[model samples]
Target: MSRAAEAAIAASYKALKEDFVSNLTGGEIGEINYVTAVAPVALVLWSALQTRQSFFKPYTPLSFAVDFLLNVCAILLATTLYSSTPIVLNILLLAPVAIIYALPRPPLSKKPKVPPPKTKDADAENPLPKKPFLTIYRGAMLVVTCLAILAVDFRIFPRRFAKVENWGTSLMDVGVGSFVFSAGVVAARPILKEQLAGKSTALSTRLYKSIRHSLPLLVLGFIRLYSVKGLDYAEHVTEYGVHWNFFFTLGFLPPFLALFQTAFAYIPSYAGLAILLGSVYQVALEFTTLKAYILTAPRTNLFSQNREGIFSFFGYLAIFLAGQSTGMFVLPRKLSSTATTGTEQRKRLVLTLGAWSGFWIALFMLTTNYKYGLALSVSRRLANLPYVLWISAFNSTQILCFCLVETFFFPGVYKATTAKEEKEAYELATSRVLEAYNRNGLFVFLVANLGTGIVNMTVKTLDVGSRGAMGILGVYGGLITALAVGLDLYGISIKM
Candidate 1:
């Protein structure tokens, strides 16, 4: 080979090596960005097709335009991993491109709002039930208390025994376990209420309610307990720690949401304050020795590795709460004439802010020497202030982008056969995204965990060559994605 060709080959090998190391170490962005980015594109394309006018014939041109732009932007951002320039520059270049493509242009003409089908009519008077403040406060207390018990357990027991044997199993135990427990109790509420003929029955009802309400609390405890255990187990098991950390965290989400709704009723600005406080807390934590201290002795202090600690839990809660709050804020508002008039303009504004914020946050995270290992460290908790801030900012930006796409670009995507269909689709999408969150999200995550475990036990065990490994990964990933997409399309089945 020529000298130049040899140098080129060597450089390519070096990049591949870095990528491999990053993936093994959990440093690389991996397939997450692609999956998330693709979902919205698909939704938008569907919307375009569903809404096309009869006169327009095939809307292939517009579909192709949107798809081309979305793919191009996604490629640019994904490939920028190999670039030497700062992440800020990459974000700057990529965000605008994505936003521009995503901005909703008016349909050739305004189609009259199709009155929802008679069978699909929402009961205007029924309304969603009001969430109560006491419920949220009590749930929070339960989570805190459980975490406290786990902390005590950790201190008393040997580290190895204290942890769960299988992270995936632990997640299944906690995540699915909580859902089953909660659902069973909730389902029996009417029977339990009828049996309340006396004070004793009343007392039983109260106790049952508390357990039902705090199911999320129990799930959170299991997640923390087992996640830490999974990390330890990974030292031996390597590939299949059977860890479903995300599911464990998410199992608590529905109750958490219920609680937040109740709390928000009392303190309307609480959502905003949560976001502000979380952001500030994260930023402060990042710039100090706080990060190092967290890793060194996470269990020694109240704020240490405890996932349900006020600081860490609330920080993530802020994200979830913010998402819910935004939905609540938008759902009731009749789109004003001004909003409709400036749809394109407002979209540009949100996109601009999202892009700008995303740039700075991405830059900050990449530059920081934070370890990107696959094993989640309770001690080296990235849930600390800086990591929290970065993830929060990124999450918020993405949510905003998602909302804009839904609002302007894909308005009718969720309009299915009935009101229930619409409601379910929205819920499922939100749940899927939340499943990917670091804390307090459950259902879709069980799918991820089981998928990971199956992959590890099967294809991952093969002594494949590089090409073979790539092929295995491709097939495995394709199958998993297809299965997930199918389940999502068919309606998420929350398995216990």
Candidate 2:
């Protein structure tokens, strides 16, 4: 083809791509509720199978298949094939099967079991507790994120499930916010621990560490910006901005929070900061010209060009603080907290996390009410108050469900038990595949992004039929899942 012909073809493809993702209004909140329910149910189903000693076993090919089906394929169906149906009803219909598998099995023999070996004061060390539920919840967020990034390219994927153009809620939008919330959950762990231990560090040292921690993400953001521009890749510019990307948003948050390091001394302080930031930002958007500027301002300067990313940082920061607040309560107890017995901690975990979830969801409903409240719409573009609350509420609820499943089906997991029994129960309670993803989440996410690029460059995603799209997605998801599981089985963690 001639140079002009090639240029014309490229232009056509770009137009098609841009048009494909534009002007999308997201689905109802009720539908999202049903869709998000699939992940926890899958967790229950997988653990139930393991507890039953069914054909599924940890780290085996069969287990990998089950994990993929439950985690990957199940999500695909929820978002696409079964989207119109009442998903929660299907879950209820299948509850019996899950219960049967979850029921305790009788021993195969009447022979006495071996007694646990005793050690000398080992339990006194008071190690931090294992949080299988948090791990699985983060893994679920990553998995859903990976799936949406690629699947959105195909025709079979619903436009409503994509990120809304200006103001609305969607699965992909939730994915982005949940990812930030999830990261925030563990971001300040070391800082909080240090405060608890009464250890003081120099301000310069804290600043240095925060920058060092966020440096990789900043570099990745730059890399994405250049690669997309260099390859002339399809991009939804309004999603972030002319040059801004999601990585940039994720990168800036760490250091920003680090500036408020003193607040880490008190957990509830995070809640206060989050509320203040979110509410103040919302007021600015509402009462001032900021919202109009973000929506209609010309992009003649660098700041203007990336106004969405720059302005939305505050909203995301609030969401991050909210996550930190939730994490302090829902995460495993600290060393000082080890005095609480497992059963009591379990009860407290359920109630506290449940209360937080209810609080956020209630706040979201009030703010979104057109009659009685602020009457704001959720906007991922702006990362407004409703958006932050929606993300926190959804993720908190999901995490609560994960905790309940872990506690109910694997009661001994958190109890004082023999090392061998604990190991077995832990394995039974969580998916090894998800554990792999949790172990090296950043690496898996990077791999998925690279794979999506390669597939998009090679395949005509818009032209592909539903069957073809499914096949390509299956292979892509399978490869990514296998890589995570393989690395985990070999005890390899590719951390920065």
> Which candidate's TM-score is highest?
2
List lDDT for all candidates, in order. Answer: 0.36, 0.79
Worst 10 residues of 2 by lDDT: 119-128
TM-score of 2: 0.89
**Highest lDDT model number:** 2
In candidate 1, which residue ranges exceed 4 Å CA deviation?
Answer: 1-248, 251-266, 276-293, 298-311, 333-382, 403-441, 458-466, 485-492
**TM-score for predicted model 1 compared with the true structure:** 0.45
Off by over 4 Å in 2: 1-24, 54-58, 86-89, 92-115, 120-123, 264-268, 334-340, 417-421
lDDT of 2 by residue, 1-496 (tens): 3566445545654454355435448988888878878888777777766667543542567767877888777877777666677475457535856566667775554557876567432234333445788889998888888888999999888888888888778889999899889988877576566666789776678778878878888899999999999998999878889999988888788678876665645644787888888999999988765776676666778988999999999989999988888877665453235546768777877888899899998999899998988878888988999998999898889889999988887787778545555556666677776787888888899889999999999999999998899899889988989899889988998865
Candidate 2 lDDT (Cα, 0 to 1): 0.79
Which residue pairs collide, candidate 2?
none
